[model samples]
Target: MTIRVVAKNYVKPEKVQDFLGLCKSLVEVSLKDEGCIDYGLYQELENSGVLTFLEEWKDEKSLDQHLNSSHFKEIFPLLSEYLEKETEVNVYRKTL
Candidate 1:
């Protein structure tokens, strides 16, 4: 079954633009991964420095692979520095 993930990143104020730049590359690379159905990146306009990702993957395995993928590893350290708080990720599956 497809898994849905909502990942939130609250970036530090001064690093907002830098974070966006980092995300652009991360998004570009993530989209090319196997079993990645959808990967959408967006910034919360009203709340600066807040970014969110809505993703859909083929399965838990696909999602797990993505978590460990090189793209993730490459960007995580850079992304971490800009975060104001721990990144929050919510995972789900449709029951309907």
Candidate 2:
């Protein structure tokens, strides 16, 4: 079954724009991955520093592959530094 993931990041107020820019490349790369069905980023309308990712994957195994990818490893450190708190990642499956 396809998996849907929502990841919310509370970024440092000053670095919000920078973080968004960084994610642009990450999104591009992720979307090109074989396992990624869809990937995109969004900034909360009310809170500029809050960023969220809406992603869909082919399956849990694919999502696991994505987590272990080189791009993920590279961006994680940068993301960690600018994040105000730990990222909140919620996963789900579609139901008929």
Best by TM-score: 2
**lDDT agreement with native, every candidate:** 0.90, 0.92
Give one digit per residue, the lDDT tens place, for model 2 in 9-33. 9999999878988898899999988
Give the Cα error of residue 93 in candidate 1, in Å: 0.6
Model 2 stretches astray by more than 4 angstroms: none
lDDT of 1 by residue, 8-85 (tens): 999899998888888898888888888999998877879977899999999999999999998898887788889989
Pairs clashing in candidate 1?
Answer: none
lDDT of 2 at 85: 97
Q: Report the poorest 10 consecutive residues by lDDT, candidate 2.
A: 72-81
Tell me the deviation in Å of residue 20 in model 2: 1.4
- Taking every candidate in turn, the Cα RMSD to the unseen true structure, in Å, is 1.1, 1.0
